[model samples]
Target: MAVQANFENIASYLQQFSHDRSIPPLEKWNPDYCGEMDLVIKANGEWWHEGRPIRRQKMVDLFAKILWKEQDDYFLKTPVEKIKIQVEDAPLLISAVDQVEIDGKQYLQMTTQNQDVFVIDAEHPIYMRAFDGEMRPYVKVRYELEALVQRNVFYHLVNYGELYDEPNCTCLKLHSGDAQFTLCM
Candidate 1:
């Protein structure tokens, strides 16, 4: 069937980059732009193609692994091709958060909808970005990619935040590992 063939092609293309379940080296790939793909990542974190939602979790995970952001555009990159895709907001969403303590230090661990888990640290700092006239929380996920923290998750994060007085205003500060993030300026 056409679907099976397409899936096999994608799997084969991805096989060379699969080692220890790490992300593919997208920065090393200099593929030519192959134009647009009929794919869209909705603001609500839904992945759609050709007017229908992509219902397979494995397929979505595979696509997420190939996602790359260049300047203001998003693309799915392979060794030989780079295809643009639409992203309404961020390409991913932070769906869950957990507070973990180690050696008397607390760390916030966030999980994306794609099941990617990362600790909020210096490398993965959270920041506020204006979205729809309101400042929302976003965190750096990987190279040039960010994940918008969902409303409920943001609220959960707020529970662990503290109000710190700055020279100009009061700021909500959240800590994870040795890094501190300001939710607002």
Candidate 2:
């Protein structure tokens, strides 16, 4: 049975929430930023890649797939997936995001809070109307983007389009207008 909740005035409320919310600025960005990636070295002690370091656009595509390869299990670390939000009835899947790792070490971050101030369910309506900066919920997903947000290493939606061009891995549009994802090469 579907209950009719009055979401008639929710869109305006959501807009205010989006406009006031903020996150730390990305230090740098990569169009092809993949986390904890491995680069092979030759017997001759020369630097080498599994394949030649591809063109920038190609690298971005590859990075997205690598992260999404084990989408569910990857986030198993902090376990951010258990979510019930006011956004939709379906539970949101929050994944662990390891920004980048080099020499077997990388930085990792997990999603914490993803709330929807719309439709008014579990909070005070007065609180909903309240616009205090301190009380606003950081409702979007946050990844440990140790890599710069403006780099060309991965397919950054800020610069390029989707992260896959060959073999067709699974791709996803992230919460950010300038961010998207893919799974497996």
- Winner by lDDT: 1
The C-alpha TM-scores of every prediction are 0.84, 0.19
TM-score of 2: 0.19
lDDT per residue for candidate 1 within 16-134, as digits (tens), equals 65543467888999988777767899988899887899998767777788899999999988887777889999998999999999778999999988788989998888998887787
lDDT of 2 by residue, 1-185 (tens): 11112111222223333433333222222223223222322222122234454234323222222221122222111111111111111122222222444345332222311321121111211011112332211122234211111112223322322343455433322322222233222
- CA lDDT of each candidate? 0.84, 0.24
- For all predictions, the C-alpha RMSD in Å is 3.6, 23.5
Steric clash count of candidate 1: 0
C-alpha positional error of residue 50 in candidate 2 after TM-score superposition, expressed in Å: 50
* Model 2 weakest 10-residue run by lDDT: 120-129
